[model samples]
Target chain A: MGSVFTPRNLLVAGGFILIALGIWSGEAGIVFEKAIRVCLECIGLG
Target chain B: MTRTPKIINRLIIQVAALFAYNPFLHNFLTGELYRGGSKYLCTPGLNCYSCPAAAASCPVGSLQAVLSGRNTITSTYVVGFLLLYGALFGRFICGYLCPFGLYQEALYRIPGRKLIPSRKVQMLGLLRYPIFFLLVVGAPLLVVDTFGNGTAGFCAWICPAGTLEAGIPLMLTQQSLRSLAGILFQWKLFVLILLSALSVVLYRPFCRFLCPLGLIYGWFNRISLHQIKIDSSRCTTCGACVSSCKLQISIHTNPGSSECIRCGDCARACPHGAISIGFDIPTSQARTVTRN
Candidate 1:
């Protein structure tokens, strides 16, 4: 069996840390702000 | 005749994922995009955020928006979301979850002479890397307006999913928006139509040749928690898996190929039951499997 410290597990850990950082740093709110408004550009209007 | 277990399972997941991404059915009728809390969260698949019924944000759209924003603070949420998903499931998102992926498959299922792409044509798959870098990352970060904010160039200029899921629907419902259809809309419509036509003759032409999201997820196929294992002890190299795969990859030689969408087709096709898909510690024999 492979060790617990496999690259997959390490990357997974890194992902969680970044997610935590994003949530704490208000990045989720930024994403929410963009998502709530309908950008004409996104729909190919602009 | 009953559908194979892989097909049945994939269909179930894809359907469930579709509903999960766009649960607000009433919005479709109202011709208004969903503005719910779920919009804060990104869907694993390439569902459009502006899609009338979409309840969640699209990762690519979100990524571009974040990149183009004037704010100096780089957002980690989208990156983390993608990384976590990639590490956990890889291109399984493309095979079994993406609404756009499902759309391509449905298009392919239409009655027609399915065409296998030539190896030279298959080289088009390399376009996704440049697309991901230039359109998704570079353009949004580099090209800014007078206000110092850049545009989501990929969504604005390309992205047939947005055009199909949001543009056409919105235009149909809102009479005012119909007047806004110009060169860009025309170009997008043309792309959507052309791809739709190609999809009838070719299996998942978009997923195979385009789709930056698939490009991202594919990078993690070698190390994802979920894996496809070929048990050497039970194996006869009869080439069943490769023949069964629509992606046309040699699974026995390289089970962790980036081209593999993890649809579990190969596992079902293995007559000897040598192939399996799940989370497990790699054994001594399985370690010999090569990565692409």
Candidate 2:
């Protein structure tokens, strides 16, 4: 929709792919849960 | 008109910090950190998942998770989002936004250390890249236990942004949170305090030394739309702007340094107005040098 092959454009596209891959494969959820667990552990909730 | 900028800035500050408070945005609050980021490349900021008000995912945390790769390459959500953000905004995300950067900038307002001379600033500035590579990525895997699990080294141990926004507040309110306090937490919190103190005396110690996002963004500084330029015709090479820069780049020598955040301080400080930030160098802008 805009300029081709710029850093901003590339990164945005890449970011979208990451989000999609993360959600579609459920991999995103795993990372999210793990991250939350680690962070929660910091405060001893985990 | 009088309060408009203040109101806007404050609102931005709140949105950046408190969006999680809204129930509609709660997916961002409770969803996996990488889940939200994998979906949409949220701005790189200190917005925390645990914060009652934060709805956006933390980018660096998301990055670490992806790099560590929980088995396979993880997911597409993060990549898609990052592509969109990086494509649309480039490094502008670092400037004019990002709550953690804003917080550090605010702390820097404490006003003690004079902006260091450009030469020394340039010398020390080289350290940020290696730190970004080693601490942000390498440390996590290397520091992992026999279970073959890794930690988000930067977030778990060093990032002041996490400490200031997530760790401290959560710990202060929940008494049971005291159980989480350990030697590692205390040690990391101490690092946060040191960075906070440095922010008062210096400018963005973390951004300059340890921020992976800044490391990423800084790579695009020269090509980014919002860029810094030296009006070569106007420049006397007196180096005043160089000394004035908190990021410590030699505007006279390298006007478009990767480390330059395009903060406008150098442009504003120039006696001859020899520096300007824009998409391209100005062929004709005002040119004059005055007595010191």
Candidate 3:
């Protein structure tokens, strides 16, 4: 079995940390704000 | 005749795509777009945030939005979500969850002469990296409006998935949107139509050539926890798997190639049962097996 501290595993752990930080820092809320409103430019209407 | 394992997998994945978009059942009945808190989360596939039934944000769209926004705070939410998915499943999401990918497969199933991509066509898969770099990241970061806000270049200019999933539905349902339709909408519609028609003959043309998300996830396929493994001890170089692969990959040599979506078609096609899809095995084992 591969060690738990393998580089890949570490990267995965880092990914989780990043996600947590993003949420805690309200970055997720920013994404939600953008996502809730339909950006007409995104669908190419503008 | 019984359905093949590949068919079963596709069916399960199609249902997953449906559930991913319609997580909030109420949105289906109301036909009103979900604007709930769950929209903050990003799905593992190419679902459009603008999709009326979508319960989550699109990672690609969110990444572009963040890059374009003038906000000094650089959030890693999109990157983290994408990295997490890529590191775990890689292109498996493309094969098993993306609604657009399922759409392409459904179109290919139609009664028509399927276009077998040539070696040159397969090489075109490399083009997606540049697209990811330029359209998804670079353009959004570099090109700014008069107010210094960047544009969501890929979503605004290139994403056919967004056009199909969001634009058409919104247009059909909202009378007010009809008056706002202009040249940009027409251009997107034209692109969507062209891609839809192309999908009937080509196997996942967008995934193969255009999807930036695919390009990003594919980079991790070689190291992803869930991956396709080839056991050379049971293998014959019969070339059966290659013919079976829609992505035109050589399974024995490069099972984890970025173009591979982990659809398991190659594994199912292998008469020798040499190819296996599983979790928690390092790709080094596959290399060792092939060398022996």
Candidate 4:
């Protein structure tokens, strides 16, 4: 359907593409690494 | 005499929030915080990672940390998770899941002169977008130290939720942290106190005016798989839904508004039962089907 290609659909497609790219690049490990430490600055102590 | 569905939903989410932070029960009993491996996965709602009882990472904080890291190329995980959430549930997490949202709603239940948001207050809601762009995304990408590391601008400067949920509790629990308290800590504490007081009078002031995570999810509300829908054939624009909506959405005119958290309050309040929530096909496709 012609209406299926609306801007909202495009945005959702873009989101899916970004997710694929993230998995391809191995960013999960980086997220895991950052999660382990309590960043003092995050809670404003630093 | 009977409890409303909204009250039941609120109680269910309150229990969920309690369970989300329940991993460190033993730590609380022994006067210690759990620092564990489970913190790696981001929770669906805005629970602060720094909370002593938190077992999962915060998506917004993780996004900032990844973007501000020396190598920015590896932020796919955080972005992917955020995108997945946005596309699926939008602000449903904000209305029913976020710990801070529950806290604010609980404060609002206190007997007081409730301030219905004025036009000016509604206009202030637009500020969340720029806050998202500048502090959450822009500053992290643009401003970097000599080592090419960025700062979590929103977390470091403005997150009252973080200050309330994590900073205050941590300081009260850890004696060493109290000695290290400085002007920045005081500033954040002041913000926390002010927001807490305001939430008693106004509904979800932080979510309406300052939450970047809400802004991010709002962009997808119109297109998210799970959404609030209104059947026009069954509808009369009697203004009941508008009054029922805590977020001040005009559901008859724009059912899937960005401000709507898919909370189903409007549906519950509707006299004709015109509104519903479900994982339906996109609105445009549904419109095309109607036209044919």
The residue-by-residue lDDT of candidate 2 on B181-258, one tens digit each, is 888778778888887887887777777766767667666665555566676888999888877777767867886576
TM-score, predicted candidate 3 vs. hidden true structure: 0.91
Model 1 stretches with alpha carbons more than 4 Å out: B1-5, B281-292
Per-residue lDDT tens digits of candidate 1, residues A10-33?
A: 888888898898889788887888
DockQ for each numbered candidate: 0.75, 0.36, 0.71, 0.48
Q: Name the candidate that leads on TM-score.
A: 1
Q: Candidates sorted by lDDT, descending order? A: 1, 3, 4, 2
Number of the top candidate by lDDT?
1
Each model's RMSD to truth, in Å?
Answer: 4.3, 6.9, 4.1, 4.3
Structural similarity to truth (TM-score) of each candidate: 0.92, 0.73, 0.91, 0.87
The digit string of per-residue lDDT tens for model 3 on B1-292 reads 1112476866787777868675765553444678888988898888888888888898889888777777633558788888788888888888888888888888888887989887887788788877888878887788888887887778888899889878887787777887799999999888888888999999999998889999888888988887777878998899999988877788789978888887878888888888888565557566656887
Docking class of 1: medium
Clashes of 3: 0
Positional deviation of residue B234's Cα in model 3 after best superposition, in angstroms: 1.0
Top-scoring candidate (DockQ)? 1
Cα lDDT tens digits, model 4, A2-36, are: 57776556666766686577657756556566655
lDDT of 4 by residue, B194-279 (tens): 88999999989999998989988888888787777777898899989999988888988997788887777888898998887756
